[model samples]
Target: MKLAELAKELHITTDSFIKFIQDFDLELSECISTDFEVKEDFARFARENISFLKNYQKDLEQPKTVEDIAGNISQPADKVAEVIRKEKPAIYENGVYRSSVSSFGVDQKLGGDYNFVYNYFGKRMPLAKRDFIGYRDLFFYISKALDPFANENTTLTDWGIHRPAGIILYGPPGSGKIFWAHKIAQIIGYQFKEIKKYYLGTSFVDGNETSFNDFLLETMKQEKVVLFMDDFDNVMMERTATSSVNSCDEETKEIILHHIDRFEEEELLMVASANTLTGIDREILAPGRFDVVIPVFPPNVQERAEIILYYMTKDLSDEALLKQILEKNNADHLPFWNEISARMKVFSNTMLIDFTQSLKKRIRTQYLKDNSLDIDIKKHLQPALREASAKLTDEYFEQMSRFIKDISVNNYDDFATRIENLKQELQHYRIVEKPRQAIGFTHNSDSK
Candidate 1:
């Protein structure tokens, strides 16, 4: 079962359940899969410790301070403050820290004797059963955004929260912005249609000439359609004295602005995928236009593990040689994959897919040569790791840094934990000898 579903069964919010696990010194790995699947270990623990779980859930509902958490865990307030400092952008107002710091992810940094016992049990959930791996929080946020469309007559609409006419999914390249754009289409019951280069300017459609204006007008005539435009930032970039904005791009931006006002009435949603919002024109980003911006982050360590496992074992039977080899290395489970994934910090989704493809070929070659499953999985993995990590060039890092800056300004509150975790991962690369500030990660003190 998914964590949200498991939390529902326990009559508590998923956030509360997650906090319960973290507040105590419990191993989240044993309790949940990389995809947030509720392992039998966590399910049984919640069942057995129902009272403790409920009480903790109640406690999390209220605002918590360093003193409150220290008292709950029987630790010193000063020590708690030190721990809170470790969580970046620690919000403080009128004396107490923000809710973001409440369920402090000390992760054994602060030692205390917790009253609850955590039991480890059960196998990881099958990859096929998961709707998508990780990004549970992002998925939930998108669902809430679409709630106005789903329940047209509800208070969300009464509160003037209609479905967004346009949404901009911003992230570094290969972070899966296009994937989320399609997902938004699915959520809002719209047909997905890519806005191609031809659709933007002028091109032959069925051997006839068609302009961008005609393409958009035709789309609006249809009901419940999502028009996806990739690399949107390049086209909608702000006109400036120093920068030469493309005439075609400027015309495209003007065309979009002209037709966007009618999108909501026509049941059409435009989803644009951009590498960063830093260059997008402010006129396009105005309140009633493409203002709904979402960030598509690269896979975190745990998510990278799940994604690797998924791609490696995709469509393989239990009797397959590759499957047997993975089983031997425990690569079929998260723990085995975790070791490799930890080293792949800041790797993109495309890199993970490339790594799996290369590894599979190496494994197949070894099996063919020896006619045995006695393959050194890690030995085969090394070359693949090197090959994939080659793509982590200076350009990619600069783009990623720009994305981090954009999201930090736009969506920090929605993703504080993820932002902090990514920042920690990115710090590893900044240590390499290079030009000062080459990677563009700001010091925590300066950034916050």
Candidate 2:
């Protein structure tokens, strides 16, 4: 199961929740043990005595007993009982925990031509169970992407050779499409190799089609390769000066088509991505060629929340922490999580503010409390007031005029101080929000 699913069930941080269950064996412990039940008195004692237990651990410099450390949980036994079904230790494999790794964009082309990876931003949706309206179709799409022949992967009898199904993801830049593909692949345990859709499509051996054809045939013979082609748009559009859109160019297309057919016939998996479908020659991705056409777009709220939880795995995990991380970062949860997981230190809270409408308004309230937004300044900043009052949106952007009204500046030194404060505010916003831009989402306030 995905981490977010478990996190939601337990209402704890992903790291904490996962560690307690999968890593620490707490979840399994309860399943196996029938005799043990936490007593109310015992729970209270544990809660009240946590400070002493911590001090004892500090003094002893080693574990004294299971009860000695109180499961590293400082609250009452009831609290622990509430969070975990029960506490029993189970041994976990060493090296089970690993730091999250980020994939820098990869470059691969179908032939020797297009250099950049085709970009896509797909919605990260939860699995569906019918009764649809508000439910986005991305989950079904992901299931298909994960198992290209998802329906067919269950074949009972062998015909010739059964190559496993793989997928192709193509879409617009900043669409966050490829990331979703990677996540689905991760869930299913497929080794991923991102190919930048670069193809010279330049003729070989006096422009004999055999050169590229032979090369592609050699590649097709390799096993378990997804053959992810990015930017399929550039090569297929017949943009090459070398291959004019003539009959000979059509022949070049044939060589390419033949190899793709070979991969399909042989049951080898291939996923090719393109930003603009029109750029791609229709013959390549036509019905029998690629199995499915999955369109990826920027995340809606639920998908963004799932991604935020995934990224914040290294930081805090619960609703509270998620809210904080979103607010601290000041960007929507998706980009913040994507960026922070890169440098996040494990343990305790990693900062993010909640990007939800309610949470953002709460944050604004906190800001108002922290600094005085007095009546005089409010009177002077009528335009700012009008702008902020313009709608019932959860997002509220206080104008710079309000910022200026509050500051009493006298000369250059004071101005510099104000500038420094402004710099800090802007800096926090950048630290919080820039990653959204990094992963290709627009950095507008609406994104939050």
Candidate 3:
């Protein structure tokens, strides 16, 4: 490109470009020397300008020292940053997880009465707020265990409450164990931590994971309590089904047990959970180690009904029905009542209703120019007839009793009519009447 063209691209006047060129003792044309040469001066011109160019180069290339560089930034930035980093550790990284009141996500509707049921158990309850069964005993154990630790390590903090309990709850998955564990931190409004055990594998500075240990430890010093050592189970998995399934993975269970053995008391209360503490290797579950160990089991029928009632919408009366189902199920350890599943009563009606609407639309589009299935079963059809003779006979019971009495008294035609009415009644139950929801933890025959 021409020297003038280059100057225009640089947003310089030809005069300014000449001044820049003059600093190196070159004319506008001379600055271009041979057109092919990008950065060189003609020999005679360079001989005269060499000293000036060297001085200019020296001025441009001289670098700032460490003190000079530091001075260039806002003053006292180091002190300000140190304060913030110390107050809230630079190591903490936050993420969100989906949790529920009962540990398993409860199927509930928004803006409904059932919402409270989930919330009732969502927050961590304090000594003051907990209403769940066994809470009083758990609190007592925690207080007694922490008495020594609190006496030793706990110092004056802004909040009067001192945490002395360091607990590990291990049980079957989906057994509401973890939810209860984190609720401790949640109850006191403290940060809940899942210790990155990978960080504690060896001395930190080996890599990112281990380095987080240095960060996590510092945060532990400041926060009221945090759940750490995020490895959900270190020992229980060893003897359980998982040890075999996951044997290929790195890290022996010994490392985890070792960490628990060597742990120092911090102000933070640690909470951990696993499926079974029985196999957790005694090293980890030792008295000073876990402080307390509590096990959780599935709710009994009454408890299950309470939970179900909490989620229900229709509030159907079903006392006898519940009795019948419970009596049958109580024979063994049944996991759940399929009859009480949320989708049960709603499906058949929804399917039938949606089916009829689509059928109507198809009839309108395919057959009629004016378009519609003229014979609409969804709207007009009521109940269906009983196919089984036994069911027919059962349906005709009240009428049958009446019929038999009438016949005995010699009224045969009326008896026959009564039998027919009873059969009609039986047909109504088959028509798929809307099932009333059993709002409470029950499947009662009576529509409560």
Clashing residue pairs found in predicted model 1: none
Candidate 1, residues 116-197: lDDT per residue as tens digits? 4632444544775655677766776676666666656663546867668899998888888888888888766789999888
Number of clashing pairs per prediction, in order: 0, 42, 22
Choose 1 or 2, whichever is better by lDDT. 1
Q: Residue 57 of candidate 1: its Cα lDDT?
A: 61
Question: What is the per-residue lDDT of model 3 for residues 1-448, given as tens digits with 9 covering 90 to 100?
Answer: 4344543444433333332332222222233322212223333333344454343333323343223322433334344333222322322121111110100111111111333222322232221222332222233333333433433434325334333345765433343555565645544456776665455445535453444435545655674655644344542354545555244122434443444433444556667765444344555555655646554333323333333322221232455332332334341122342323222121122222333344334434443453332333222112211111213333334333433343334322312333333335434445576988768765565646
| TM-scores of all candidate predictions against the true structure | 0.80, 0.36, 0.32
Candidates in order: C-alpha RMSD to true structure: 7.6, 24.2, 33.3
Cα lDDT listed for each candidate: 0.78, 0.37, 0.37
Candidate 2 Cα errors over 4 Å, as ranges: 1-136, 145-168, 183-190, 197-215, 238-253, 265-267, 305-448
Report how far off residue 118 is in candidate 1 (Å). 9.4
TM-score winner: 1
